[model samples]
Target chain A: SQQGEEDPQALSIQEGENATMNCSYKTSINNLQWYRQNSGRGLVHLILIRSNEREKHSGRLRVTLDTSKKSSSLLITASRAADTASYFCATVKGDSSYKLIFGSGTRLLVRP
Target chain B: DTAVSQTPKYLVTQMGNDKSIKCEQNLGHDTMYWYKQDSKKFLKIMFSYNNKELIINETVPNRFSPKSPDKAHLNLHINSLELGDSAVYFCASSQDSQPQHFGDGTRLSIL
Candidate 1:
């Protein structure tokens, strides 16, 4: 099983600015996913970038995956106060079962 | 309507007691998972079920058991709970190649 570890356990940023969080995994992965969890709430899926894909974008969310480095980055452009949450990176291996192994997480505080 | 929902958002139990958390997903998804969020807010997968078939079972203790009566419902039962069992438990569901949808979560406190 592959696990992802995020950098900068916590982050504080101003609204309207872009926030970048990086995640590095141990082994090869079939896909990498990003999830956001608000205070005292369950995690909500944000985006997913496959191993073969180098980059993916969804509105203000951008995910880049580098297979060689076994790392991935998630960027939120023009972040808003609503974006304040703990972001986690999850990896899914190539096995038939696509179970996810989650990372510690990056707590992003968007100070408005 | 919420896609995924868990019962008793908050559970307070004493040690050596048995408790269960119920989860249901109206999204008609075939896969459901149970995750444990520790004090540090680290989410870890405990178990997963696909259409009532056990798929992923992590290194969780034997005292914790997951029961999937059907594809839409997966319930967790803990026997002789300990202090270490206290944490936020989340239930999630997903379709093939789709993102996961999580329930609000159940905050279990064992005293």
Candidate 2:
């Protein structure tokens, strides 16, 4: 079953602008991870935030997790045309399951 | 070197035909997985293996069989393929609970 649901099925933003995507999950998770997939390519891990951690950052990518709300957000600062791609949120259940339940994903288009 | 690689980036065949997709990882990871992405871009786990042992098997059909000849190799074979099997299949590998590294994907189209 799918555990995560991302908001704004699609988003269009201009270069240099900031893009934000939200993800909501249904169950308790050991960790939440954000991945990016370019057109015709595989997914690349962006950042992972543990349930006990509220926020994490990698370069221009910032991720926040709120276990109380079972929600998380990914923010890309100074978006570039290369940032245009589909972003997905995946959850690892706290039950020691190795499977990753992925969301439908958010398609982001960054215009140059 | 590619951390994970899958063979036959694209596969096109008719229904009722049998086909196989092979995957290998050079990261020396203990766990490997196979996922399918539907037309709607919904990704789902099909199977997982750890140390050459099947560990996670989702509600997939029996027509789909996975084989792990060794810890670094995992292959998926489908028999009597159907049109519904047309999708992008990805192979991934990881160590324990760490993040996974995925292959580009195999775009399968069944007529």
Candidate 3:
């Protein structure tokens, strides 16, 4: 099993500015996923980046995975107030094959 | 229709009591999972069931049991709950290689 740990536990930014969060895992992963959760709500899957891919994008969200660093970063472009949420990175180990481990998450607050 | 639904969005109970949270997924996924989010917002996997069979148990106490009557339903039952058991419990389901779809979660407040 792999453990994903997110940095910058809390981040505050203006609506137009970009918001970036990073995650690092302990072991090799088959895939890494990012998720978002609004206040007191369940998690919503955002994006998944496979180990072989270096970057992936969906609409305003972009994710980059660096296998050498064992790290991944998620960037939200032109963030809006509605984008305020807790973001988490989860990793599925290449060996474990079944379970996905979640990180402690980074809380982002986008100012209107 | 909601893909995944969890009943009793909020649960308030006393210590030493037994409680259960029900979850159902209409997506026809093969795997269902239970995750606990603590005050720090740390989500930890407690249990996972695949096609009505227990597949993943993550060192959680035996007092916390997950029962899957069928592939679509996975219920969590806690016996003799303690104050530390207070947290938000999320139910999720997914098929192989698919992202997990989560329910709104059941907030358990132990008094």
Top candidate on TM-score is 2
If you assessed candidate 2 against the hidden native complex, which CAPRI class would it receive?
A: high
lDDT of 2 by residue, A1-112 (tens): 5789998899999999999999999999999999999999999999989999999999999999999999999999999999999999999999865889999899999999
Ranking by lDDT: 2, 3, 1
lDDT of 1 at A35: 92
True contacts kept of each: 0.72, 0.79, 0.72
- Candidate 3 chain A has its poorest 10 consecutive residues by lDDT at A95-104
Instruction: Choose 1 or 3, whichever is better by DockQ.
Output: 3
Check candidate 1 and list the clashing pairs.
none
> For residues A4-55, could you state the per-residue lDDT of candidate 3 as single tens digits?
8898899999999999999999988999999999997789999999999999
Query: Candidate 2 lDDT, tens digit per residue, B1-111?
Result: 989999999999999999999999999999999999999999999999999999999999999999999999999999999999999999999999899899999999999
Please provide, for model 3 over B1-111, each residue's C-alpha lDDT reduced to its tens digit, 9 standing for 90 to 100.
999999999999999999999999999999999999999888998999988999899989999999999999999999999999999999999996589999999999999
Clashing pairs in 3: none
Using lDDT, give the best candidate's number: 2
> What DockQ does predicted model 1 obtain?
0.75
Query: Candidate 3, which segments miss by more than 4 Å at Cα?
Result: none
Local error of candidate 1 at residue A99 (angstroms) = 0.8
Error of 1 at A51 (Å): 0.5
Better of 1 and 2 by lDDT: 2
